[model samples]
Target: MDRVLADDLHALHSLVSGLRRDIHAVTAAFSTSWSSGQVEGHVTRVKLLKRMGFGRANLDLLRRRVLRSP
Candidate 1:
């Protein structure tokens, strides 16, 4: 990381810096088996459906769409 940061010509400098800033979280993610991937996927799916439906979808329609989605 230091080597990459030290090299002015390196394209990875910015990425390395970001990784350094969030090193603890990055390491924890690698070390831990627990994750919110399923919850996040559900949230993303719901948000996409809401966006697609926009002002036309009612609560029941949205509920049905969400329930029916894979």
Candidate 2:
């Protein structure tokens, strides 16, 4: 009974190890440079520019203001 339980545990560990390796390979193949940090920075800059514009600038003007200033 003890030997059977140990064998079952060993098989489960092997399966889990294979799954982890497969997941790592998949992530490595499909990752991108555009990460959460970049997205957060863009969102923060947009909000800052919107507040600075005081709700008067049109979309095109606002976009120009944000992109052209810095």
Candidate 3:
């Protein structure tokens, strides 16, 4: 951060100012490599399948689709 300030204080200040509220969260995310994208995708798939089955398919069919699709 000192090196960054030496090179460009304005940019450093801008970045810090922009991320002040979430500085800890942003730094933690960069330091760690955990994500919920796959879980989110599965949830999205389930939601879409449910919508597609809207009043037409029964629970059995929906269950089968979820199991088979995944």
lDDT of all predictions, in order shown? 0.92, 0.73, 0.85
lDDT by residue for model 2 (1-70), tens: 3454467577677666665669876576569554478779888988888888786877888889778865
Worst 10 residues of 2 by lDDT: 1-10
**Cα error of candidate 2 at position 47, Å:** 1.1
Tens-digit per-residue lDDT, 18-60, candidate 3: 6766889889988888998999999999999999999999999
Show the colliding residue pairs in model 3.
Answer: none
Clashes of each: 0, 0, 0
User: How much RMSD separates candidate 1 from the native structure?
Assistant: 3.1
Question: What would the per-residue lDDT of candidate 1 be over residues 2-67, giving only the tens digit for each residue?
Answer: 888778857898899899999999999999999999999999999999899999989899999999
TM-scores for all candidates?
Answer: 0.60, 0.42, 0.55
Off by over 4 Å in 2: 1-35
- Model 2 lDDT vs. the true structure? 0.73
